[model samples]
Target chain A: MSQGEPGIELDTSLGYMLKAAASALHSAMEAVLSPLGMTITHYSCLELLAQRPGLSNSELARGAFVTRQSMNVLLQSLERQGLVIRPARAPVGRALPTELTDLGRRQLEVASAAVRRVEQNMLADLDTDEQDQMRRLLRTCITSITEPPASTT
Target chain B: MSQGEPGIELDTSLGYMLKAAASALHSAMEAVLSPLGMTITHYSCLELLAQRPGLSNSELARGAFVTRQSMNVLLQSLERQGLVIRPARAPVGRALPTELTDLGRRQLEVASAAVRRVEQNMLADLDTDEQDQMRRLLRTCITSITEPPASTT
Candidate 1:
C-alpha cells in the first residue's frame, strides 16, 4: 500500500513497467553477450557499422545511446583490436568515419546471432499483430518523452 | 540501408524499439532527478522503501534491478545522508530490513512528482486502453526473456 504523498503507483506506472522490461532484456543480453567479451554498447557499435558502414563517432554514440567520451574510448579499443578502422587524419572536417574491419564483421556474426535469439525469445509469445502493435506503441512512447516539453517558459 | 548479415533491422525490431523507449524515459527522468541530486536508482531505492518498508538490501537490489553489492554501497550512502536506516546488527538473519527516515520521505516527495511527470509525458499520446495494451505487451516481453531457454540438453 502506498503510504502517503511522494508515492508513485509502481504497479500501474507504464514507465516503471518499461524499466522492468528493459532491465530483464539487459540481463538476458548480458547472459549471452558476456561470454563473448562484448558489452551491449560494443555489440551496438559493431551492429551500427555493419548497417551504416562509415558512421562517425558521434553518430555511433547516438545510435548506441552512450556519451561521446565513452564511445571514443570504445572506438580506440576496437581499433587497437583490429575490429574497426579509421584514418589517422580526418578525410574531411574533424570527424573520422569509422568502419568495421573484416575481423569485426566476423566477430559480429556470432554475437549478432546470439542477440537475435534473445530478441526472438523476447517476442516468442507475441503474434505478428501484437509485435507490430508493440513497435508502434513503443515508438509513440519514445517520441512523447524525447520531444521537448511544450514551452512553459 | 542494411549492408548484409549480422545487421539488426533497427527500424522494425521490437527489441530495438523497446530500448529506444526506455532510453528516452531514462533521459527524461535523469533530467529532472539530477536537479534533485538523485540518481534513478537512488530515487528507486527510496521509492521502494516508501511503498514496501523494511525490505532487505538484496530485496531492494532485485526490485531496483541492481547488484546487491551496488545496492549495499547505495544503502550505506543513504544511511550516512540520514535518508534511510538499518539496524547495526540483523534483528534475525543476515538481512537488514531498511526503512526510510522522515528526511527520506521529504526528499522522495519532490523526486516522485518529477518522476510522475516524466511517466505521464511518456504516456501522453496513449489513451487508457492503449496504455493497458502497452503494459500487457511489455509484461509478456519480460516474462519471455526472464524465463529459462526452454530445456536445452
Candidate 2:
C-alpha cells in the first residue's frame, strides 16, 4: 500500500503529549500513594465515594478508567481491608452501592493530603488564569472526543 | 488523627481534569482502533516503533505506560504474527532492539491515520495559539511530575 501519511510527529502531537502528562501524573501519584499502602485506583475509588457516596461498582470503574471486573476485584480487596463497605444486598438494584468506612476515610485523609500536594506541585508553575485556561481547554478537548463524530460524507 | 485537609475538590482539580481528558482521549482512540483490530497499547507500540525504530522492550513499555512484563508479552505476540523482529541474540547489551516489519509499517499507517483523526477531533475547537499553549502547559506538568521533588526543608 502507498506509504501511509508520515506517522504522527510524536514531538508535536497533542495526543501523545497528553498521554505523557497523564503517565507522569500517574507515576507520581503511585510513588506517593504506594508508601501509604494504596494504589492510584484504590485512592480514586475512595475519593469518588467520598465526593459522591454510594457510587456503584460500575460507576467507580468508569470513574477510575478500569474495567468493571477489575473494580469489582479492587472493591472486594478494599472491603476485606476494611476500607469500604457495601450492603449484603443491593437496596434497590443489582448495583451494590459502596461507601468509605471510618477506616477508609481515615486512610483517605493521609493519602488525600499527599495526592493534593502532588496535584499542587503539578500546577505550581501555572498561574490561576493559566490553570483556568488549561481547564477550559481540557474540557473542550474532552467534549470533542466524547461527542458523536460529525458527518464525514 | 486530626482531620486531614479537605480532599481535593474533584471539579476544580487540574490533575483530575487531566486524567479525565486523557481517559476520554483513550476511549476515543480505542473505539476507532478496535475495528482495525488493535488495542490502544498495541497501536501505541506500533506507532512508537514507526517513530523511533529500534526501541527496546523496556523503552517501549515506558512509552506505552505498561509494565515491562506486559510489553514483553505483547512483543512475543507481535513477533509471532510477523509484525516485528528482533535478532536472535542481543547485538551488544541484553536489551534486544525491536524493529517493525513491512507488514507492521503498513498496519501502522492505517492505525496512525485513525489516531491522528481522533487527535484532530480532540483539537477541533482550539486555535493554533491555544493548541500551542496546551502543549506548553502539558509539557510543564510532565516536567514537574518527573523532576526530582524540591527540597522540603
Candidate 3:
C-alpha cells in the first residue's frame, strides 16, 4: 500500500506509458481507417497481404494479432465483397493462401498512404536516432516479457 | 508498392513493434491476473481506484482506455460484488465518484503484487537509464499521435 513499495505509479511506469502510446496509436489509426470503411485490424490484414501476398488465414491472423476464428469470419466477408479470393480448396495443405483482388489493391493504396501519414506524424518529435532507440527499447521489453521469469527464490 | 518507398516493412516498423510489445505485456499480465480471477482491465480499474480513489466512471473509462458504456457495466458488477461503491444518486453533477471498499483494497493488494512482478520481469533487460528513456520516448509517441496532424500541403 506504500507509494514507494509495490504500488505502481501510473505516471512513471514504462508499462503504463507503453499501453498509453499503443492506445493513442490505435485510436489515431482507427480514426483514419474508419473513414475508409476499415478497422485497424482490417487495415492490418490488407497491409499484411499487400506486403506478402499468398498468406494463409492463420498467418494473416498472426500478423494482424487477431484470433484465427475472427480472421476467418473477416476473410469470408472480404471474399464475398470481392476484395480477396481463395481457391475452393487448399492447393497445398489445409491452409488456403489468400490474395487481394485488384480492387483490394487499389483500396489499399489509398489506405496505406493515410496510415503512413499517421505513423510519420506520430514520430514527428523524435529524430531518426531516437526512433531507432525507441524501437530497440520496445523490443527489449517484448523479449523480457516473452522470456521466462528470473529465478524467484 | 515498391520496397523502400511506400511499402511498410513489417519486420522493422516501429508501429508494429509497439503493438508487439503491448501484446506481450498484455499476455504476461493476463497470465498472472487470470489465475487471480481477474482480467487486465479489471485489475486496471482497481489499481486506478487504489491510486486515485474517487475516479468517476467516465474518468475511469478514459484512464483504462475503455468505452464509458463498457466501464459502466463493469462498475455495476464491481458494486454488486461489494468491491466499490457509488452514491444512489450523483452527489455532484451526473458523475458518481467511485471509491473502493475495504474488500476492494484487499483484492487489489494481491492483484497489484502480481502485476508488479510482470512489469519487473518485463524490465529485467533494461537498465535504469533505458527505462527512463523508454518512458520519455513513449510519452512522445503518445503526444505525437494525440496532437493534431501537421498541416499537409
Listed in order, the DockQ scores are 0.59, 0.49, 0.54
Model 3, residue pairs in steric clash: none
TM-score of chain B of each: 0.95, 0.93, 0.94
**Residue lDDT tens for model 2, A58-122:** 99999888999999999999999999999999989799999899999999999999998899888
* lDDT (10s digit) by residue, model 1, range A26-108: 88888889999999999999998998888999999999889999999999999999999999999899899998899999999
Model 3 bad stretches (over 4 Å): A1-8, A150-153, B1-5
Each prediction's TM-score against the native?
Answer: 0.95, 0.89, 0.93
Local lDDT at A109 for model 3: 86
- Candidate 2 stretches with Cα past 4 Å from truth are A1-8, B1-5
Model 3 CAPRI rating: medium
Off by over 4 Å in 1: A1-8, A151-153, B1-4, B151-153
**lDDT values, one for every candidate:** 0.89, 0.89, 0.87
Residue pairs that clash (backbone atoms under 3 angstroms), model 1: none
Q: State the displacement of the C-alpha of residue A28, model 2, in Å, after optimal TM-score superposition.
A: 0.8
Output the number of the DockQ-best candidate. 1
TM-score of chain A of each: 0.92, 0.91, 0.90
